[model samples]
Target: MDYLRSTFVILTVIMTILTLLPFWRNQAWWVRVWDFPRLQMATLSLLFFLTEMALMPFGGPAAQIVIVLSMACAIYHALWILPYTRLYPKQVRASRLNNLPTLKIVTANVLMTNQQSDKLLALVEQHQPDILVTLETDLWWQAQLNVLENDYQHTLKCPQDNLYGMHVYSRLPMQDPLIQCVVAEGIPSMHFRVTLDSGDEVVLHCLHPMPPSPTEDDESTNRDGELVAVGHTAARASFPTVVTGDLNDVAWSRTTRLFMKISGLLDPRRGRGMFNTFHATFPFLRWPLDHVFHSKDFTLRDLQRLPEIGSDHFPILVELALNPRVGKGQRGLEIEPGDQFEAREKMNNAGVKSRHVHTAEN
Candidate 1:
């Protein structure tokens, strides 16, 4: 019993640290990464708290206090998670009429080493999406996607082996397609205008920012900088805009939330579900790293996570109807006084000196 109590107390202390670390909102990898596993933390914290209480009903005051701390940790994470659940109101309204022109996008981070091209190809064929964006695709993967050219004639390809390669194949007519290296020279993002059948044009920005990991950058600064940079750029777009890709940050993270408010885009996942797409091999350790965020001019037609394609990340498809005529679905994000200032600061801090220009080969 003593051993078990000690174990529970130690777990409680660990959970408490995880809970408090995110509050710092530090761009350091260890601190920011904790934001990605709030769901797991909430569940584990609550479980440990209850199990400890049930097992040690007559524990000393110190043990009881530690148990209570675990419960508090659970509540803190729950508050952040609540907005993404159905219990909270959805940020984007659902599509009521099918007649509106719809733009369906499928975004996936295909592990560069995974050779299951057929799996992704099958999914693209099944969905018949208007635009398909794949990340971490190498020259070999690009060849595998060649079959899509006959269908998705409007193409933008920036193939590299640095695990940041991006390819966008669109059935709709695309104009002025340019691939910009947002932060690093090899890390590219696609910017283009796709004309819909309704004669309306919507700007599409596809990005796969490098994540904050030991193998990758040790800090989240680069990811946060690229995101807010795009956020500011998208904010200036006059046409209806959509940004979809593997953001490498969760929906609830400080940077992501700041990007939302700065860009004034709506997340379809809010009130729908988490639609967690990463760690496809590990069912218990997944989060929504792949995302689809759009301007209020669009409404959710359908958003879903497709089957695994042998990559660490699953594909996410979101069909949004073009209907600014219907009025903004939700109130625009109230850009706090510090939001824009902090956005600029993030870009400055990351030392984003790139011209963000595209090569001649679009």
Candidate 2:
């Protein structure tokens, strides 16, 4: 009985230590996987700490192991909750533009099998954003979304039932809209250039890759590979860019962070909050999977989560202001130079081979 108790206690300690692996030295890989089940980790950690305290009266090898496990779990819980503390810090100065051209973009994953087109159309009409991007779209979904054509002049539709299905609609003039297969078969992404009335150009890339799941794709490598490859492409582009879609990864994950660093884009949520968009039905088990990342040439005007439109994922609405005065020093969010090296290594480790495309036009 004593030996069994000891074994259980040791196993618990090991599991507690595993939770803290995210903060260990050079542990980006650890942090990537730690992104999942964050809420459950927090709750379990707290419960373990209380259990250890109650077991103090029964001093033995089991008690000692429980105490150690409790400490480790507590530390990890604290670390996991710390990143959100200064997510969106208060800016020292506000923009001077009184009449800035605010571009509102919305992104939603409409679940390919869902037939509630009326709810989605109602949400879009209510928001009236400048651009709308939908994931998991099929032929029927495309046909239903055609109602948006009167407001949005430009469209790029890749309506497939596969994991990569995507559709994009824009009120601004779009140039060279094309669907590019990023990594695996059936995973397509839409790329286009939006020409604003002020003559400023903004390149937009819409992506929706297959997520990692036991029943779906057993490996997350392809999804990670596709994002990194697209990140590299966006990084090399000269124009200001906005990459939006259902990324299938959390905003704070190593892969997502690396993508932001490599692409040199700014996350509006950084000084704000986690715009948790997935699993709309269960808000508690949600993470910010749908995102809008823009170059520093633009500043955030506003951002919010749209009401549920009968899909598992909620739509993200973001309004950005073009800062004409933003120059070399204030182009966008600045990431440490070392981050790029780490990002490159992670991408390589994920088996993402780099291939450059001259333009999305071809």
* lDDT at position 89, candidate 2: 59
Model 1 scores what on Cα lDDT?
Answer: 0.87
Residues 1-362, model 1: lDDT tens digits: 78888899999998898888878857878888898998898999899988988888777899779878988999999888888889888889998998999999999899999999999999998999999999999999999999999999989998899999999999999888888877877889898988998999988888888888888988999898888888877777878989889999999988999999988888999988899998899888988899999998998899999999999999999999988867474765688888878888999987763234231223
Which candidate tops lDDT? 1
Candidate-wise lDDT, in order: 0.87, 0.73
TM-score attained by model 2: 0.84
Cα miss at 123, model 2 (Å)? 1.7
- Per-residue lDDT of candidate 2, residues 235-316 (tens digit): 8777778888998887766667678767777777764566678888986687778988877777767788888888898889
Estimated TM-score for each candidate: 0.96, 0.84
Candidate 2 CA-lDDT value: 0.73
